[model samples]
Target: MKSDVIADWAARPGRHIVNLSGGKDSTALAIFLHDKIPQIEYVFCDTHKELPETYDYLDRLEAFLQRPIIRLNAQRGFDHWLNMYGGMLPSAQVRWCTRKLKIEPFEAFVGDDTVWSYIGIRADEGRSGYISTKPNVHPVYPFKELGMTIADIERILETSGLGLPAYYSWRQRSGCFFCFFQRTGEWVGLKEHHPDLFEEAKKYETERGGEHFYWRQRESLAELEQPERIAQIKREHALRLEQERKKRPNRPLIELLGAVLDAEDDERGCDICHL
Candidate 1:
Protein backbone atom coordinates (compact mmCIF):
# COMPACT_ATOMS: atom_id res chain seq x y z
CA MET A 1 0.00 0.00 0.00
CA LYS A 2 2.80 2.44 0.92
CA SER A 3 4.75 1.47 -2.19
CA ASP A 4 1.69 2.14 -4.36
CA VAL A 5 1.26 5.63 -2.87
CA ILE A 6 4.96 6.38 -3.44
CA ALA A 7 4.79 5.10 -7.01
CA ASP A 8 1.70 7.15 -7.72
CA TRP A 9 3.38 10.32 -6.45
CA ALA A 10 6.51 9.59 -8.50
CA ALA A 11 4.38 9.51 -11.66
CA ARG A 12 2.30 12.57 -10.76
CA PRO A 13 3.19 15.83 -12.47
CA GLY A 14 3.73 18.58 -9.90
CA ARG A 15 6.41 20.40 -7.86
CA HIS A 16 8.55 18.19 -5.64
CA ILE A 17 10.04 19.70 -2.44
CA VAL A 18 12.16 18.29 0.38
CA ASN A 19 12.20 20.44 3.51
CA LEU A 20 15.58 20.03 5.19
CA SER A 21 15.60 20.39 9.00
CA GLY A 22 19.44 20.13 9.39
CA GLY A 23 18.89 16.76 11.01
CA LYS A 24 20.39 13.43 9.89
CA ASP A 25 17.23 11.86 8.49
CA SER A 26 16.28 14.80 6.29
CA THR A 27 19.91 15.28 5.15
CA ALA A 28 20.05 11.62 4.18
CA LEU A 29 16.73 11.92 2.36
CA ALA A 30 18.09 14.87 0.35
CA ILE A 31 21.16 12.80 -0.62
CA PHE A 32 18.98 9.75 -1.30
CA LEU A 33 16.73 11.55 -3.78
CA HIS A 34 19.22 14.03 -5.29
CA ASP A 35 19.59 12.08 -8.54
CA LYS A 36 16.21 10.36 -8.54
CA ILE A 37 14.24 13.62 -8.33
CA PRO A 38 16.18 16.00 -10.54
CA GLN A 39 13.53 18.70 -10.36
CA ILE A 40 13.09 18.31 -6.63
CA GLU A 41 13.46 21.57 -4.76
CA TYR A 42 15.27 21.54 -1.42
CA VAL A 43 14.34 24.19 1.12
CA PHE A 44 15.12 25.04 4.74
CA CYS A 45 12.90 27.23 6.90
CA ASP A 46 15.40 29.52 8.63
CA THR A 47 14.31 30.51 12.11
CA HIS A 48 17.37 32.84 12.15
CA LYS A 49 17.76 31.52 15.69
CA GLU A 50 19.24 28.20 14.59
CA LEU A 51 22.66 27.08 15.79
CA PRO A 52 25.78 28.05 13.83
CA GLU A 53 26.52 24.39 13.27
CA THR A 54 23.14 23.99 11.54
CA TYR A 55 24.00 26.75 9.08
CA ASP A 56 27.42 25.18 8.45
CA TYR A 57 25.85 21.75 7.87
CA LEU A 58 23.38 23.21 5.40
CA ASP A 59 26.20 24.94 3.52
CA ARG A 60 28.04 21.61 3.22
CA LEU A 61 24.84 19.92 2.04
CA GLU A 62 24.30 22.63 -0.58
CA ALA A 63 27.79 21.90 -1.93
CA PHE A 64 27.00 18.18 -2.08
CA LEU A 65 23.62 18.71 -3.80
CA GLN A 66 25.31 21.12 -6.23
CA ARG A 67 22.16 23.27 -6.06
CA PRO A 68 20.93 26.00 -3.84
CA ILE A 69 18.82 24.90 -0.87
CA ILE A 70 16.31 27.74 -0.84
CA ARG A 71 16.20 29.41 2.56
CA LEU A 72 12.70 30.62 3.48
CA ASN A 73 12.62 33.17 6.26
CA ALA A 74 9.65 34.26 8.27
CA GLN A 75 9.00 37.92 7.47
CA ARG A 76 9.81 38.48 11.13
CA GLY A 77 12.18 36.39 13.23
CA PHE A 78 11.79 34.78 16.69
CA ASP A 79 12.15 37.97 18.76
CA HIS A 80 9.48 39.69 16.68
CA TRP A 81 7.08 36.79 17.16
CA LEU A 82 8.01 36.57 20.84
CA ASN A 83 6.93 40.18 21.36
CA MET A 84 3.75 39.71 19.30
CA TYR A 85 2.73 36.97 21.72
CA GLY A 86 3.45 39.20 24.75
CA GLY A 87 6.92 37.80 25.58
CA MET A 88 5.57 34.35 26.18
CA LEU A 89 8.25 31.91 25.03
CA PRO A 90 6.91 29.19 22.71
CA SER A 91 6.45 25.91 24.56
CA ALA A 92 5.30 22.42 23.58
CA GLN A 93 1.67 23.31 24.43
CA VAL A 94 1.64 26.63 22.56
CA ARG A 95 4.10 26.24 19.69
CA TRP A 96 3.37 29.41 17.78
CA CYS A 97 7.06 29.38 16.78
CA THR A 98 6.71 26.31 14.56
CA ARG A 99 3.50 27.62 13.00
CA LYS A 100 4.86 31.10 12.39
CA LEU A 101 8.51 30.38 11.65
CA LYS A 102 8.32 27.07 9.77
CA ILE A 103 4.90 26.13 8.44
CA GLU A 104 3.80 29.59 7.35
CA PRO A 105 6.99 30.31 5.38
CA PHE A 106 6.83 26.84 3.82
CA GLU A 107 3.18 27.35 2.79
CA ALA A 108 3.93 30.77 1.36
CA PHE A 109 6.81 29.27 -0.64
CA VAL A 110 4.52 26.70 -2.25
CA GLY A 111 1.52 29.05 -2.62
CA ASP A 112 -1.32 27.31 -4.52
CA ASP A 113 0.94 25.06 -6.55
CA THR A 114 0.31 21.31 -6.21
CA VAL A 115 3.32 20.09 -4.22
CA TRP A 116 4.61 16.70 -3.19
CA SER A 117 6.53 17.44 0.06
CA TYR A 118 9.20 14.80 0.67
CA ILE A 119 9.48 13.97 4.37
CA GLY A 120 12.39 11.96 5.83
CA ILE A 121 10.46 9.90 8.34
CA ARG A 122 11.95 6.39 8.46
CA ALA A 123 10.12 3.05 8.28
CA ASP A 124 11.35 1.99 11.74
CA GLU A 125 9.75 5.04 13.33
CA GLY A 126 6.02 5.20 13.98
CA ARG A 127 5.77 8.99 14.22
CA SER A 128 3.77 10.84 11.57
CA GLY A 129 5.28 13.43 9.24
CA TYR A 130 4.21 17.08 9.29
CA ILE A 131 1.77 17.21 6.41
CA SER A 132 0.55 20.73 5.76
CA THR A 133 -3.20 21.24 6.07
CA LYS A 134 -3.10 23.17 2.79
CA PRO A 135 -5.17 21.26 0.23
CA ASN A 136 -2.53 21.60 -2.50
CA VAL A 137 0.31 20.20 -0.40
CA HIS A 138 0.83 16.44 -0.10
CA PRO A 139 3.38 14.68 2.17
CA VAL A 140 5.48 11.78 0.88
CA TYR A 141 7.91 9.69 2.93
CA PRO A 142 10.50 7.91 0.76
CA PHE A 143 12.40 6.45 3.72
CA LYS A 144 9.25 4.76 4.96
CA GLU A 145 8.37 3.47 1.50
CA LEU A 146 11.89 2.05 1.02
CA GLY A 147 11.98 0.59 4.55
CA MET A 148 15.18 2.50 5.43
CA THR A 149 16.25 2.94 9.05
CA ILE A 150 18.94 4.74 11.06
CA ALA A 151 21.73 2.51 9.78
CA ASP A 152 20.76 3.25 6.18
CA ILE A 153 20.67 6.99 6.92
CA GLU A 154 24.15 6.79 8.45
CA ARG A 155 25.44 4.93 5.39
CA ILE A 156 23.99 7.54 3.05
CA LEU A 157 25.64 10.38 4.96
CA GLU A 158 28.96 8.52 5.23
CA THR A 159 29.05 7.87 1.49
CA SER A 160 28.06 11.45 0.69
CA GLY A 161 30.91 12.81 2.87
CA LEU A 162 28.52 15.27 4.51
CA GLY A 163 28.36 13.20 7.72
CA LEU A 164 26.34 14.44 10.70
CA PRO A 165 26.22 18.00 11.98
CA ALA A 166 28.73 18.86 14.73
CA TYR A 167 25.97 19.43 17.26
CA TYR A 168 24.97 15.77 16.98
CA SER A 169 27.75 14.87 19.43
CA TRP A 170 25.90 16.59 22.27
CA ARG A 171 22.42 17.36 20.98
CA GLN A 172 20.66 14.60 19.08
CA ARG A 173 18.20 16.76 17.15
CA SER A 174 18.40 20.16 15.50
CA GLY A 175 15.84 22.94 15.78
CA CYS A 176 16.53 26.01 17.89
CA PHE A 177 19.28 26.51 20.43
CA PHE A 178 16.65 26.91 23.12
CA CYS A 179 14.02 24.46 21.97
CA PHE A 180 11.87 23.62 25.02
CA PHE A 181 11.56 20.02 23.87
CA GLN A 182 15.27 19.64 24.78
CA ARG A 183 16.22 17.38 27.65
CA THR A 184 18.05 18.68 30.74
CA GLY A 185 21.30 17.24 29.44
CA GLU A 186 20.92 18.92 26.06
CA TRP A 187 20.27 22.22 27.79
CA VAL A 188 23.50 21.66 29.71
CA GLY A 189 25.24 20.90 26.47
CA LEU A 190 23.99 24.17 24.99
CA LYS A 191 25.14 26.13 28.01
CA GLU A 192 28.56 24.54 27.89
CA HIS A 193 29.05 24.85 24.13
CA HIS A 194 27.27 28.10 23.36
CA PRO A 195 27.24 30.20 26.49
CA ASP A 196 26.37 33.33 24.56
CA LEU A 197 23.30 31.74 23.01
CA PHE A 198 22.45 30.20 26.36
CA GLU A 199 22.57 33.68 27.90
CA GLU A 200 20.26 34.96 25.17
CA ALA A 201 17.85 32.15 25.98
CA LYS A 202 18.08 33.14 29.65
CA LYS A 203 17.06 36.71 28.79
CA TYR A 204 13.75 35.39 27.43
CA GLU A 205 12.74 34.22 30.89
CA THR A 206 11.51 37.53 32.29
CA GLU A 207 9.76 37.93 35.61
CA ARG A 208 8.07 41.30 35.27
CA GLY A 209 6.43 41.98 38.64
CA GLY A 210 4.70 38.60 39.12
CA GLU A 211 4.20 37.18 35.65
CA HIS A 212 6.92 34.69 34.76
CA PHE A 213 7.68 33.09 31.40
CA TYR A 214 10.30 30.34 31.30
CA TRP A 215 11.51 28.22 28.40
CA ARG A 216 11.37 25.05 30.46
CA GLN A 217 8.05 24.55 32.21
CA ARG A 218 9.75 23.49 35.43
CA GLU A 219 12.85 25.72 35.65
CA SER A 220 14.45 28.75 34.07
CA LEU A 221 17.69 28.57 32.10
CA ALA A 222 19.48 30.49 34.83
CA GLU A 223 18.46 27.95 37.42
CA LEU A 224 19.22 25.07 35.11
CA GLU A 225 22.73 26.40 34.57
CA GLN A 226 23.57 26.41 38.25
CA PRO A 227 26.57 24.24 39.06
CA GLU A 228 24.64 21.84 41.30
CA ARG A 229 21.79 21.45 38.81
CA ILE A 230 24.18 20.95 35.90
CA ALA A 231 26.09 18.33 37.86
CA GLN A 232 22.92 16.46 38.74
CA ILE A 233 21.68 16.48 35.16
CA LYS A 234 25.03 15.17 33.89
CA ARG A 235 25.15 12.45 36.56
CA GLU A 236 21.65 11.26 35.69
CA HIS A 237 22.48 11.28 31.97
CA ALA A 238 25.70 9.33 32.55
CA LEU A 239 23.77 6.73 34.58
CA ARG A 240 21.21 6.32 31.79
CA LEU A 241 24.00 6.05 29.18
CA GLU A 242 25.65 3.27 31.17
CA GLN A 243 22.35 1.42 31.48
CA GLU A 244 21.68 1.72 27.74
CA ARG A 245 25.22 0.49 27.02
CA LYS A 246 24.50 -2.64 29.07
CA LYS A 247 21.33 -3.28 27.08
CA ARG A 248 22.81 -2.53 23.64
CA PRO A 249 26.54 -2.82 23.98
CA ASN A 250 27.22 -2.45 20.27
CA ARG A 251 25.11 0.69 19.81
CA PRO A 252 26.98 3.89 18.93
CA LEU A 253 27.42 6.51 21.63
CA ILE A 254 25.50 9.15 19.71
CA GLU A 255 22.53 6.80 19.23
CA LEU A 256 22.70 5.78 22.87
CA LEU A 257 22.72 9.43 23.93
CA GLY A 258 19.59 10.06 21.86
CA ALA A 259 17.84 7.04 23.39
CA VAL A 260 18.78 8.15 26.90
CA LEU A 261 17.52 11.65 26.24
CA ASP A 262 14.28 10.26 24.81
CA ALA A 263 13.85 8.06 27.87
CA GLU A 264 14.39 11.10 30.10
CA ASP A 265 11.65 13.02 28.36
CA ASP A 266 9.84 11.35 25.48
CA GLU A 267 7.86 14.38 24.36
CA ARG A 268 7.38 14.47 20.60
CA GLY A 269 9.01 17.53 19.09
CA CYS A 270 7.45 19.71 16.39
CA ASP A 271 7.87 17.59 13.29
CA ILE A 272 8.42 20.63 11.10
CA CYS A 273 11.36 21.83 13.17
CA HIS A 274 12.93 18.56 14.33
CA LEU A 275 12.43 16.27 11.32
Candidate 2:
Protein backbone atom coordinates (compact mmCIF):
# COMPACT_ATOMS: atom_id res chain seq x y z
CA MET A 1 0.00 0.00 0.00
CA LYS A 2 1.13 3.57 -0.64
CA SER A 3 1.27 6.34 1.96
CA ASP A 4 -1.77 7.91 0.33
CA VAL A 5 -3.68 4.67 0.79
CA ILE A 6 -3.17 4.82 4.54
CA ALA A 7 -3.94 8.52 4.56
CA ASP A 8 -7.15 7.81 2.64
CA TRP A 9 -8.10 5.06 5.05
CA ALA A 10 -7.45 7.44 7.94
CA ALA A 11 -9.66 10.05 6.32
CA ARG A 12 -12.61 7.72 6.74
CA PRO A 13 -13.85 6.85 10.27
CA GLY A 14 -14.81 3.18 10.12
CA ARG A 15 -11.91 1.66 12.11
CA HIS A 16 -8.23 2.61 12.19
CA ILE A 17 -6.11 0.21 14.26
CA VAL A 18 -2.45 -0.36 15.09
CA ASN A 19 -1.51 -3.54 16.95
CA LEU A 20 1.36 -2.94 19.38
CA SER A 21 3.64 -5.91 20.12
CA GLY A 22 5.71 -4.09 22.78
CA GLY A 23 8.60 -4.60 20.40
CA LYS A 24 10.77 -1.83 18.96
CA ASP A 25 9.37 -1.78 15.43
CA SER A 26 5.72 -1.82 16.45
CA THR A 27 6.20 0.78 19.16
CA ALA A 28 8.15 3.01 16.78
CA LEU A 29 5.37 2.70 14.20
CA ALA A 30 2.76 3.66 16.79
CA ILE A 31 4.61 6.87 17.58
CA PHE A 32 5.35 7.55 13.92
CA LEU A 33 1.69 7.35 12.94
CA HIS A 34 0.20 8.94 16.02
CA ASP A 35 -0.93 12.23 14.52
CA LYS A 36 -0.93 11.01 10.91
CA ILE A 37 -4.16 9.11 11.33
CA PRO A 38 -7.28 10.35 13.03
CA GLN A 39 -8.89 8.29 15.81
CA ILE A 40 -6.27 5.56 15.52
CA GLU A 41 -7.01 2.64 17.80
CA TYR A 42 -3.88 1.12 19.30
CA VAL A 43 -4.02 -2.39 20.73
CA PHE A 44 -1.83 -5.09 22.26
CA CYS A 45 -2.66 -8.80 22.24
CA ASP A 46 -1.41 -9.95 25.62
CA THR A 47 -0.50 -13.64 25.92
CA HIS A 48 -0.49 -13.41 29.76
CA LYS A 49 3.01 -14.85 29.60
CA GLU A 50 5.04 -11.81 28.46
CA LEU A 51 8.17 -10.53 30.10
CA PRO A 52 7.81 -7.83 32.77
CA GLU A 53 9.86 -5.42 30.67
CA THR A 54 7.32 -5.75 27.86
CA TYR A 55 4.48 -4.69 30.11
CA ASP A 56 6.47 -1.77 31.46
CA TYR A 57 7.38 -0.61 27.94
CA LEU A 58 3.73 -0.77 26.86
CA ASP A 59 2.68 1.38 29.78
CA ARG A 60 5.34 3.93 28.90
CA LEU A 61 4.21 3.88 25.27
CA GLU A 62 0.62 4.49 26.35
CA ALA A 63 1.73 7.62 28.18
CA PHE A 64 3.67 8.77 25.14
CA LEU A 65 0.74 8.27 22.77
CA GLN A 66 -1.67 9.95 25.21
CA ARG A 67 -4.18 7.32 24.13
CA PRO A 68 -5.20 4.01 25.60
CA ILE A 69 -3.63 1.02 23.85
CA ILE A 70 -6.42 -1.52 24.24
CA ARG A 71 -4.99 -4.73 25.64
CA LEU A 72 -6.63 -7.85 24.16
CA ASN A 73 -6.29 -11.26 25.75
CA ALA A 74 -7.58 -14.73 24.92
CA GLN A 75 -10.85 -15.58 26.64
CA ARG A 76 -8.81 -18.30 28.31
CA GLY A 77 -5.06 -17.80 28.60
CA PHE A 78 -1.98 -20.03 28.21
CA ASP A 79 -3.12 -22.53 30.85
CA HIS A 80 -6.40 -23.28 29.09
CA TRP A 81 -4.73 -23.79 25.73
CA LEU A 82 -1.99 -25.92 27.27
CA ASN A 83 -4.62 -28.20 28.75
CA MET A 84 -6.31 -28.46 25.36
CA TYR A 85 -2.98 -29.54 23.86
CA GLY A 86 -2.72 -32.37 26.42
CA GLY A 87 0.16 -30.90 28.45
CA MET A 88 2.38 -30.38 25.42
CA LEU A 89 4.06 -26.97 25.28
CA PRO A 90 3.87 -25.14 21.98
CA SER A 91 6.82 -25.59 19.60
CA ALA A 92 7.66 -23.79 16.33
CA GLN A 93 6.39 -26.66 14.14
CA VAL A 94 3.07 -26.92 16.01
CA ARG A 95 2.56 -23.36 17.20
CA TRP A 96 -0.95 -23.32 18.57
CA CYS A 97 0.04 -20.63 21.05
CA THR A 98 0.13 -17.67 18.61
CA ARG A 99 -3.18 -18.63 16.98
CA LYS A 100 -5.16 -19.26 20.16
CA LEU A 101 -3.55 -16.70 22.45
CA LYS A 102 -2.74 -13.70 20.25
CA ILE A 103 -4.32 -13.70 16.78
CA GLU A 104 -7.70 -15.17 17.74
CA PRO A 105 -8.35 -12.56 20.45
CA PHE A 106 -7.33 -9.67 18.19
CA GLU A 107 -9.52 -10.94 15.35
CA ALA A 108 -12.49 -11.46 17.68
CA PHE A 109 -12.07 -7.95 19.02
CA VAL A 110 -12.41 -6.57 15.50
CA GLY A 111 -15.48 -8.75 14.88
CA ASP A 112 -17.04 -8.34 11.40
CA ASP A 113 -16.34 -4.64 11.13
CA THR A 114 -14.41 -3.20 8.20
CA VAL A 115 -11.12 -2.69 9.99
CA TRP A 116 -8.03 -1.03 8.51
CA SER A 117 -5.41 -2.93 10.48
CA TYR A 118 -2.19 -0.90 10.34
CA ILE A 119 0.88 -3.14 10.59
CA GLY A 120 4.44 -2.05 11.45
CA ILE A 121 6.29 -4.02 8.82
CA ARG A 122 8.95 -1.75 7.28
CA ALA A 123 9.70 -1.16 3.60
CA ASP A 124 13.06 -2.95 3.81
CA GLU A 125 11.54 -6.09 5.30
CA GLY A 126 10.13 -8.87 3.12
CA ARG A 127 7.82 -10.94 5.30
CA SER A 128 4.20 -10.96 6.30
CA GLY A 129 3.15 -11.14 9.93
CA TYR A 130 -0.23 -12.39 11.13
CA ILE A 131 -3.07 -11.16 8.95
CA SER A 132 -6.65 -12.08 9.82
CA THR A 133 -8.31 -14.27 7.23
CA LYS A 134 -11.59 -12.48 7.93
CA PRO A 135 -12.93 -10.65 4.93
CA ASN A 136 -13.81 -7.58 6.95
CA VAL A 137 -10.35 -7.12 8.44
CA HIS A 138 -7.95 -5.55 5.92
CA PRO A 139 -4.23 -5.44 6.62
CA VAL A 140 -2.34 -2.22 5.79
CA TYR A 141 1.35 -1.58 6.20
CA PRO A 142 1.87 2.14 6.83
CA PHE A 143 5.58 1.76 7.55
CA LYS A 144 6.10 0.11 4.19
CA GLU A 145 3.85 2.66 2.62
CA LEU A 146 6.06 5.43 4.00
CA GLY A 147 9.27 3.70 2.89
CA MET A 148 10.40 3.38 6.47
CA THR A 149 13.22 0.96 7.25
CA ILE A 150 15.04 -0.10 10.42
CA ALA A 151 17.16 3.06 10.49
CA ASP A 152 14.00 5.12 10.03
CA ILE A 153 12.31 3.21 12.84
CA GLU A 154 15.26 3.80 15.14
CA ARG A 155 15.04 7.49 14.39
CA ILE A 156 11.32 7.49 15.11
CA LEU A 157 11.84 5.92 18.51
CA GLU A 158 14.88 8.05 19.28
CA THR A 159 13.06 11.27 18.44
CA SER A 160 10.10 10.16 20.58
CA GLY A 161 12.49 9.43 23.50
CA LEU A 162 11.31 5.82 23.67
CA GLY A 163 14.48 4.40 22.16
CA LEU A 164 13.79 0.67 22.65
CA PRO A 165 12.42 -1.76 25.17
CA ALA A 166 14.86 -2.36 28.03
CA TYR A 167 14.76 -6.06 27.14
CA TYR A 168 16.87 -5.24 24.09
CA SER A 169 19.84 -5.15 26.45
CA TRP A 170 19.56 -8.96 26.62
CA ARG A 171 16.80 -10.28 24.36
CA GLN A 172 15.96 -9.10 20.83
CA ARG A 173 12.27 -9.67 20.02
CA SER A 174 9.47 -9.04 22.47
CA GLY A 175 7.23 -12.05 22.90
CA CYS A 176 6.47 -14.64 25.56
CA PHE A 177 9.42 -15.09 27.90
CA PHE A 178 9.34 -18.81 27.19
CA CYS A 179 8.92 -18.43 23.43
CA PHE A 180 10.67 -21.34 21.71
CA PHE A 181 12.06 -19.04 19.02
CA GLN A 182 14.58 -17.71 21.51
CA ARG A 183 18.24 -18.61 20.89
CA THR A 184 20.45 -20.44 23.36
CA GLY A 185 22.34 -17.24 24.19
CA GLU A 186 19.07 -15.43 24.85
CA TRP A 187 18.03 -18.22 27.24
CA VAL A 188 21.32 -17.86 29.04
CA GLY A 189 20.78 -14.11 29.25
CA LEU A 190 17.34 -14.74 30.73
CA LYS A 191 18.78 -17.05 33.36
CA GLU A 192 21.39 -14.49 34.35
CA HIS A 193 19.16 -11.39 34.23
CA HIS A 194 15.96 -12.86 35.65
CA PRO A 195 16.62 -16.05 37.55
CA ASP A 196 13.08 -16.36 38.91
CA LEU A 197 11.50 -16.01 35.47
CA PHE A 198 14.02 -18.53 34.16
CA GLU A 199 12.90 -21.01 36.80
CA GLU A 200 9.24 -20.37 35.93
CA ALA A 201 9.97 -21.09 32.27
CA LYS A 202 11.71 -24.30 33.31
CA LYS A 203 8.58 -25.37 35.22
CA TYR A 204 6.58 -25.25 31.99
CA GLU A 205 8.63 -28.09 30.52
CA THR A 206 7.36 -31.39 32.01
CA GLU A 207 7.89 -35.12 31.54
CA ARG A 208 4.90 -37.00 30.18
CA GLY A 209 4.86 -40.69 29.22
CA GLY A 210 8.62 -40.73 29.80
CA GLU A 211 9.09 -38.07 27.12
CA HIS A 212 9.81 -34.48 28.03
CA PHE A 213 7.76 -31.63 26.53
CA TYR A 214 10.03 -28.65 25.95
CA TRP A 215 9.55 -25.21 24.46
CA ARG A 216 12.50 -25.96 22.20
CA GLN A 217 12.29 -29.38 20.58
CA ARG A 218 14.86 -32.06 21.53
CA GLU A 219 16.24 -30.16 24.54
CA SER A 220 14.64 -29.53 27.91
CA LEU A 221 15.15 -26.27 29.80
CA ALA A 222 16.75 -28.23 32.63
CA GLU A 223 19.54 -29.40 30.35
CA LEU A 224 19.93 -25.94 28.84
CA GLU A 225 20.32 -24.41 32.30
CA GLN A 226 23.33 -26.45 33.32
CA PRO A 227 26.53 -24.47 34.00
CA GLU A 228 28.50 -26.27 31.27
CA ARG A 229 25.71 -25.89 28.71
CA ILE A 230 25.33 -22.18 29.47
CA ALA A 231 29.09 -21.67 29.10
CA GLN A 232 29.14 -23.50 25.79
CA ILE A 233 26.28 -21.36 24.45
CA LYS A 234 28.08 -18.20 25.50
CA ARG A 235 31.31 -19.40 23.88
CA GLU A 236 29.55 -20.22 20.62
CA HIS A 237 27.76 -16.85 20.66
CA ALA A 238 31.04 -15.04 21.25
CA LEU A 239 32.67 -16.88 18.34
CA ARG A 240 29.75 -16.02 16.09
CA LEU A 241 30.02 -12.38 17.13
CA GLU A 242 33.74 -12.40 16.34
CA GLN A 243 33.09 -13.94 12.93
CA GLU A 244 30.44 -11.33 12.13
CA ARG A 245 32.66 -8.51 13.39
CA LYS A 246 35.49 -9.70 11.15
CA LYS A 247 33.17 -9.60 8.15
CA ARG A 248 31.77 -6.15 8.93
CA PRO A 249 34.44 -4.33 10.84
CA ASN A 250 32.72 -0.93 10.71
CA ARG A 251 29.37 -2.10 12.10
CA PRO A 252 28.65 -1.63 15.78
CA LEU A 253 28.96 -4.77 17.90
CA ILE A 254 25.34 -4.49 19.05
CA GLU A 255 24.03 -4.40 15.46
CA LEU A 256 26.39 -7.27 14.55
CA LEU A 257 25.07 -9.39 17.43
CA GLY A 258 21.47 -8.76 16.34
CA ALA A 259 22.25 -9.67 12.71
CA VAL A 260 24.14 -12.83 13.63
CA LEU A 261 21.38 -14.00 15.94
CA ASP A 262 18.73 -13.18 13.35
CA ALA A 263 20.64 -15.22 10.77
CA GLU A 264 20.42 -18.23 13.09
CA ASP A 265 16.60 -17.96 13.35
CA ASP A 266 14.99 -20.84 11.42
CA GLU A 267 12.03 -18.56 10.46
CA ARG A 268 9.45 -21.14 11.58
CA GLY A 269 7.81 -18.95 14.23
CA CYS A 270 4.76 -16.73 13.82
CA ASP A 271 5.32 -13.06 13.01
CA ILE A 272 2.45 -12.18 15.36
CA CYS A 273 4.46 -13.37 18.36
CA HIS A 274 7.82 -11.94 17.24
CA LEU A 275 6.67 -8.73 15.55
lDDT of 1 at 125: 91
How far residue 243's Cα lies from its native spot in candidate 2, in Å, is 1.5
* Model 1, residue 189: C-alpha shift (Å): 0.3
Stretch of 10 with least lDDT, candidate 2: 261-270
Model 1, CA-based lDDT: 0.89
All candidates' lDDT scores?
A: 0.89, 0.83
With a 3 Å backbone cut-off (N, CA, C), the pairs that clash in candidate 1 are: none
Q: Please state every model's RMSD to the true fold in angstroms.
A: 1.9, 1.9
Instruction: Estimate TM-scores for all models.
Output: 0.95, 0.94
lDDT of 2 by residue, 116-218 (tens): 8888888998888778889988888877777888888888888998888888867887898988999767888889988998999999888877887887775
- After superposition, candidate 1 runs with Cα above 4 Å error: 1-8
